[model samples]
Every structure is written in C-alpha cells, then in structure tokens.
Target: MDTTMITIVERLAWTSVQTALLVGLVWAVCRLVPSLGAATRCRLWWLVSLQAVAGLFWAQPLQLAVLPAPALAADTFIAGTDVAYAHAPALPTAQVVSAIHTVSSAAIGAAPWWALVLAALWISGVLAMAWRTAAEWRRTRALLAAAQPCADQTLVEALNLAAEAHGLRRAPRLWMSAQIDAPQVVGPLRPVLLLPAGARALQGDALDLALTHELQHLQRHDLQWGLLPAVAQHLFFFHPLLCLAVREYAQAREEAVDAAVVEGRSERRQDYGRLLLQLGVMPRPHLGVASAAPSTASLKRRLLSLQQRHACPKAVAVALTVAVLAIGVLPMRLVAAPPPPAPPAAPAAPRAPVPPAPPSAPAAPPALAVPPATDLPAAPPAPAAPAAPAKVQEKTTSTTTIMRSSDDDSLSMITHGELDLGKRPDRAYVLLDGNASYAHGAMDDVKQARRDLGADSQAFWFRQGTERYVVRDRTLLLQMQEAYADAARIGTEQAKLGRQQGELGRRTGEQARAVAMVAREEALRAVRHSTDINRDAAAEAARASLEASRAAKDARGNAELATLAQRQASLGAEQAALGQRQSQAHARAAREAEKIMAQALQDGRAQRL
Candidate 1:
C-alpha cells in the first residue's frame, strides 16, 4: 500500500485508541470523584477530545529510533583458492563486478479498500450526526420564535429575585412556550428561560423553584458546556465509551446546577425536589438546550442529594478538578508507542594470518680466468686498487607483461588483455599514492642514465624480466609539466569565473532591490498625491458649501429687506389715498355747508322781506 495511506491509517488507529483510553479515564474519574463539578468534568472531556483530534494533525511520531540491522560476518576466502583446492569457484569476476554495479528497485502498492471504506463510513456518520444536530437546533429556534413573554408579573418578579439572589449581573429573559415540555435555558450570552404553558398555572413557589433551577444553569454557564461534548460525541459516535461519557457529563452538569440552586436555600429544597419530580415526567430537553431536569434516575438522585444536602467540599473539588485535567492532557503526551528493539549483533569469524616470504639467495660473483691469475698477480702487484664506493639501488618487481607503445614510446603494463599505465596524468594533479614513489624512482633512474651515458641520452635501461622500466623520454616529461601548468591555469580561471558570477549576482540583486524601492516610493507618492487630492476636494466642497450658505443667508436678508420696503410703500400709498379721500370729503362737506348756509340766508332774507 501507499506508505502515506498506511501511515494515515496507523495514525487514525492510534488516535482512536488514545481517545478511547482518555474517555475511559474520564469515565472512571467521574465515577470515582462524583464531586468534580459537571463544568470541570465537561471541560476535561473537551480537552481529551481536542487532544485526540489534534493528534491527527501531529505529523511526527512521539519518538523515532533508528534500529540498525545486526552485523553479519562476511564470508572470507583466498583468491584463486578453488584452483588450488580443485573445486568449483563461488562466482566469476565479471559476475561479481556486475553485481556490484546493480541497483535495487521496489514496487509501490495501492491503498487498501478497507481503509477507504472505513474513512467513508466515518465521514458518513459525522454528516448524519451533524444533520441531526442541525435539525434539532432548527426546531429549537422555531420553538423559541413561537414563545411569548410571560404575562405573569409574579413570575417575572420571582425570576428577578432568583437572579439577584444568585448574584447574576443580568437576569435572563423569561418566556413561556407551549411547545416545550420542561423548563430549559437557551442561549449562552443572552440566555432565555423557556417555561412550559402548564407552568403558567404553577403555584408561586413551584414557579420560583423552577425559575431558580434554570437560572442557576444560566448563572453557572452550563449551557456552554454541552456544545463541545456534543460535537465530540457526534464525531465519535462509533465509540461507546465516548457516548457513555457524554451522557454522564450531561447528568453531572444537571446535578451541579441542582446543587448550586438548592445549596443554601434549605427551605426551598423540598419545593425544588417536587418541581424536578414533576418535570421529570415531561420529555427531555432538546439537545441544543440545557434542561433544568434530567432523566428519572438522575432526578431521583438529585432529589435524594437535595434531601441529604450532599455537596462536594471546595478543596476536594479543586483537587479532583486539577487531577482530571491532568488525566485528560496526559494522553496527548503518551500516545506514541516506543520504538522496537534493535536486533542483536552477529559474531565475526577469526581470520588466518598470512605466512611471511622466504629470504632470497645471494648473487654469484663474476668468473675470472686462471691465466688472468698470472696476469692478475702482476696487476695486483701494481697496487691494491682502492675499494670502489657502494651505490644505492632501488629494487622493483612487475606482476604483468610490460609493453612499449610505438606511437608514444611509453611503457605500459599488460594485464587481463588491457594496457595499464602506472598512473593517468592529469593537469596539476599531485601523485599522493605509490605512483608518486614510482615516478620518483623513474626520475632517479633517468638521472643516473644522464650521468653515466652522457647528457644527450635518448633512452633509459629497460629490464625485460620481473623488474621496473625507467621512463627516459624528454618529450613526455615536458608534456607532463605543460599539462600541470595548464591545469593550474584552468583552476585559476574557474575560481575567477566563480567570483565574477557571484559579483554579478550580487549586483543584480542590488539592482532589483533598488528598482523595487523606487517602485515603492512611486507608489507611496501616488497614494500621498491621491490622498492630498481627496483632502483638497473635500476641503473645496466644504468651502463651496460655506460660500453657498453665506450667499443664501445674504439672499434671505435681501428678500426680507425688500419685503419690508414693499410693505412700507403700500402703507405710504394707502396713506396718500386716505388723505385724498379725506380732502374730498372735507370739500364736499364745505360745499354742503355753503349750500345749507346759502339756503339759510335766502330763507332769512325772504322772511325779513
């Protein structure tokens, strides 16, 4: 299988095992302590679930150890031993050489079908559970929308009283709904206390008790505890222990809420017990809501605990809470298994020591004639010649045939149908191996040849048997020296080229950075310019508005002044008309008076006459 897929499968299995172990630990702790508040226990479950889920993302193993393979003793045999022993050989030289050059390949397998199936099943379960949770939440939301504010003033007062008694900063909103069976608290931040329609008719004390129970949940923030465990339970629906732990968490949470409500209020404990018993018959709260009452068994336990006033001590509760938290976090550290043990080492066999070679016989002295004894006696009589000085000579041996190449007149060893030079000459190459000694010996032989056979020598002594050949070609030595000089030149050029390339790269990078900086500066300038333009535009708009307002005020004042002037002109025209009328009336009055006076005079005159 694909190693990646196999590793994924292994990690999934390990995480599942870790989660199971953690859940069991949680379950056992909850069962043992019973005093660790539901909130604390719920938090522990959440921690373990998170740790398990987090383990999936942990790509590295907890511990990695390289278990080396055991060393095996290599089979040893002498070369050409089969010929000596008259037996078949292990392998041909060519076959062994080819085997050394061979490379190994591996086939990759496909992912197993079962792993895919398991993954698909897990995904499907999660989806199904998620859908269920969503649908229930939707139902709860619909029910919440249908609920109406409680019309009873007494219940509202009781809710406020209970909240203030519990030291709640803000009283939760209270509503009455006919859809819900039991009183449950919903919403974490702005909590809502939902009461059944039947609760409307409940006695004042029972209503107070129920309100107090649900309010205790709100005050303690138990509604927020169910969310993580619910998600964990849904995701790991396959694990029975997780399901049990979730159920236990819910029960413990309700108990904790119950204890908080009736802790100090001894007188109301009976009423609270009765309220729980009454609500216990109702359907359980929706998964999205935190009910004031749990199952019948849990209700009985709550009632008994309330009656007995059984409560966890603060110190004990704190200690257990810390311990449980440690348990939850421990799995994350210990999830990885230890690496396998290394294999034992194999013992090596002892090798046989090789025998040393025997010493060579002394060389025979050159023969001299007997007549030479008579002649030599006279020659010896001339004078015992001074003994010659000994010369140091280097010994050489050959393991293959030595051939002289006509093209280059260079000596080469013939081995296994191939000519092998003592060493391949490379430019500026220093011989650091036995080849250096061979070259030094050859140079010494050439020096001796030049000293003994004149400085214009063209060839050196060539031994035809198991002895070394001395190279004496002046052209070859000169060519070798030239090659070394060329190699040194090439090395220097390469170094110079590398330096140039590095410099060029540095310059290019600097130029790129400079261009980027310039672009940034240009962008900043554009942005500043745009900001300035916008600011000027806003300022101009404000100025125009100010000018327009001033002009409008001026226009209003001019209109008011013109209206006053027109009113004054109308008043003046009315006055002038009034004066003319008055004058006409006075003239008419005078005319009438004159006529009356004339009449009066005429009458008087006629009477007198």
Candidate 2:
C-alpha cells in the first residue's frame, strides 16, 4: 500500500467509529426519553447517518491519550568509547543481514503482504454485493414492466382520495401486479405505486392504509433523501454500525408516518395497527430498499413508538439537538496515556569506602575528530597534519582491528562489524528540531520520522532483537536552499510565459472576432442590397432574380464562416484563461515551499541540524 491508501484506510476507520457512537447515543435517547414525540425521535436518529457522512469527508485526526502507554523491552546498549568490551557475543538470530534489509524496505512503506491481500478481498466483497443488488433491481423492473392499470375502479378512486387528503398535487402512477404482495412505492422521479392484483379481494381500508403510508413517504421526501443510506448500506455491506443506523432510522420513519395515519381517529387506530401487523407478516421482496420499515424484531418497537403521543419538552429537545451537533464538531480519540515517571532508583546499601588506585598515566585521551561544519566549502582542503599512527590510538590491548577515518585520520575506534564502521561512520539524519530521527543517510528534513528521540540524547544506541546496529554519525541539513532557489526561478519563468501567452491569445481572439463581425456585416449588405459582386442584377430582368438567388446563397455561406471564426476566438480565450490559471498554480507552489523552509529555520535549529 502507498501513502494514499493508508490515508484512506485511516479515514474509513474513523468514520465507522463515528457511526457507531451516533447509533449508540441515539438508541439510548429513543428508549429512555418518553416525552419526546415520534417526530423529534426520528430526527435524532437521523443524525446517525448524517453525522457518519459528514465525518467521512471532513473529520481530522484528534488523538487523545486515554490509556497508559506500554513498556518497552530492554535491548543491548553499545558503548563505542572503549575497546576492552568490543567483542560482545552475538545473540541467536533466524535470518541473514541481506534478508533483514529486504524486510526493512517493506517496513519503510508501512505495508506487508497481508495488507494487499486484505484490500483485494474487500474489493471482491463489494463487487459481489453490487451484483446481488443489481439482480434485485432488475427483478423489480421486470415487475414494473408487467404491471397494468387496475380494473377495480373503487380501489383506484381510494388511492386518489388518499393522495388528495395527504396534500399531494398528483398521486404516483398506480398499478396492480400479482408480482408483489405488499404495496410498494418505487422510483422517486416518476414514482409508481405497485399494488397487488388481488387488492380487490382484501379489505379496501387495508389497501387504503398502505396507499396513505407510501404517500406520507412521498410527502416527507423519504425516497429521495433515502437514496444515500440505501446505496451506502450495500457499499459498506460489511459494516455493522452503518447497517444498524439505516434500520433504526427506517423504524422511526415508519412510526412517525403511522402517527400521521392514525391522528385523532379512535376507530382507525385499531385498523391501522392491524394493517401494520398484516404488512409485517406478509412475505415480500427482500431487496435492500428504503421504501418501508424492516420486519420481525423492529415491528414491536414501531408499534410501541406509535402509541406514544406526548411531545418532547422544548428545552430538553433543544439541549439534545445541541448535544448531537456538538459531537459533530468536537472531536475525540482513544490514545495511550502518557507514561508515568520512572520511580527513583532504590537506595544503595551502605558500603565501606575503598581507596582509589593511582591511575597509570591516565589512559591517553581518545583521538576524536571534530565533524565538518556547515560553513565549510563543498571541497575543503585537507589538514596539514602528517598521516601517522599515534601511540595512544594504537590497538595494543584489544586484538580487534582499529579503524581510522580516511578523510581526517583522527577517529580511532575498534571495528566490531556491527555498525557501518567499515567504509565510514554510520550516517544518520534527523529533523531540524533534533527530536525526530529520519532514515539513515537522508539529506533533508522532509523524510518521515523513523524513530522519536524524546529526551534520550545519545547519538547512538544498540537495538537488540534484530541486527545490532548503531546510529553514530549525524548529517547536516541538505542543500534545500539551492533547490528552493531553482523552484523560484522556474516560477518566475512560468509567470512570464503565462502573461505573454494570455496577452497574445486575448489580442488574437479580439482581432478574429472583429474580422468575423465585419464579414457578417458585409454578408448582410450583400443580401439586403446588391453589392459590387452582385451589381449586374440591378438592370436586367431575367438575370436579376438569378443574381438575387446567388446573393442569398452567398449570404448564408458568409454567416457560417463568421460563426466559425467566433468559435475559434472563443477557443483562443479559453486557452488564455488556462495559461493564467497555470501561472497562479506555479506561484502558489513556490510560495508554499518557501513558507515551509522559513518555518523550519525559525528556531535556528537548521544551522546546527
């Protein structure tokens, strides 16, 4: 996986979390709060889907430390100052150095073989889901094709009357088809009301209730607004929380509509309840559609919500709405809490003081070389000191070979074959802040951080588990100033190029359009009156009509030529506009790069970095 895919996965994970939280919170509110009416509860539950969508597109990472950080394992610590302990025993290992290098490259990308396999598996699952949904849609369309106008005039009249009562200007296209048992409204844009062919045999009021239910769906704009979640459920078919959200909202929507159907009618309430139970039990199409509420476990909740008629207190409703909105803007995350301060070391037991032994000529100080400074020229002159081995630097005590710097001939250290001490000191890089470590041999600060130093300021440390390696040499910041200069030069050139192109195109377009206009006027003159080309028609009788016919034909041809020229001018103008936008983009890129460099240098760390 690349950086793009990593970012996408992170955003998806966060959005899924947001959906779960919204569903959990809203579910609690609906169950616990009885005063809130059906309409208010529906709105609250709708936030689950809405917030999910919003978070997916715009939520930024807001990591919070909510748990304790884990402890790190102890590793071998290499001290390169002394030669006596240089021959540390190697730990048991499973792989060669070359194989470790290969693994390191994969780690650099933060991807493994399993990541690619999982991504491919998810794509296959989505494709399979899409295929199933398409099959259902095709079957529904086939039913729609076979449907026809109902022969029962009374049922048709009832559908129309129900629509009128629901305040619809025109009822949806009504049809009867034996293909479906329950009445379903399909397609938002030219919606069709699909009723069973055996509708005349059932109670007229039952069908009437179904019609009113679907009409309320229309009046509330349920089908149109629902398209997002309806498609989203299938797209993220594996996600549990999003599925629950869609189902919960559907139940609330149905109960809200049911309340509307029963409003103030004491007798119709019992009949509406029967209609709901009847529809819930009937086996219909299993297509993942948003036209109706789900069945089975959800039916009981829907019925319960229907019986409750008390409106929510205004203050409580406002407070909960505000709370939901706050969740959208205020962010949180589950992050490891900061580690506790290490306990002070245990007090050492009292010991008798021992007299210090006389140092044998004080082991001669190691011959360490000063690293090259930033101000030095690219090709610094070699030092005048003769290249000769000194007595103090010689490896007389340790049998291991001692390595000396080729350029300076000053550094003297035992070669243990653990570090890049063969050809040169291990060259590592760090950010200008001196806190974050970068890849070995990196010349710039923009590279991603490989490790964080925190307060441990050791220039080199040993990592035990894999290969024992050291990070000893710290390289200075690279020649970014020169690179930035080159970018600025290019931006300046682009600015000049853009101005020249835009001006040329603008003038050319203007001239072409003006010429086209002149040609059109000349063509009009030729048609309205005889110009020099058609002057022969003024006196002659028979040839006059023939010349007029030629004039009209020529006029049409000239008009078309003028139109072509106008189109060409328009194209020229578009080219000019594109050139200007390109120039702006180059300038913006140059400025952004400059700002980053300036920020990094603000603390003067770049000089020492």
For candidate 2, the clash count comes to 1
Error of 2 at 267 (Å): 2.8
TM-score of each: 0.47, 0.48
Best by lDDT: 2
Q: Evaluate all candidate structures by whole-model CA lDDT and list the values in order.
A: 0.49, 0.51
lDDT per residue, candidate 1, 1-609, as tens digits?
354555556666766777788777777876787655655665666666565656656765453233443322211221122122222212222232233323211222455677767777777898999898788779778888999998989778877887898888988888889876667777665778888896434566776667766777776666675666776677678878767767766666676677777777788777777777666554455453544455567667667666554446777767766776555544343332343443422222212312211122224436752221111001001111112223323343221112122213352211110122333212111111111111112333333333443343333222222232333344433433333332233333434443443443344344334434443443343334333322655644543453344334333322322222223333333333333333343334334333432443354421111
The candidate 1 region of ten consecutive residues with least summed lDDT is 374-383
Q: Candidate 1: deviation at residue 397, Å?
A: 57
Give the poorly placed runs of model 1, Cα more than 4 Å off: 1-12, 30-109, 152-154, 157-169, 198-200, 290-294, 308-312, 333-609
Instruction: Enumerate residue pairs that collide in model 2.
Output: 67-337
lDDT of 2 by residue, 504-542 (tens): 434434544443454455434333443222343452332
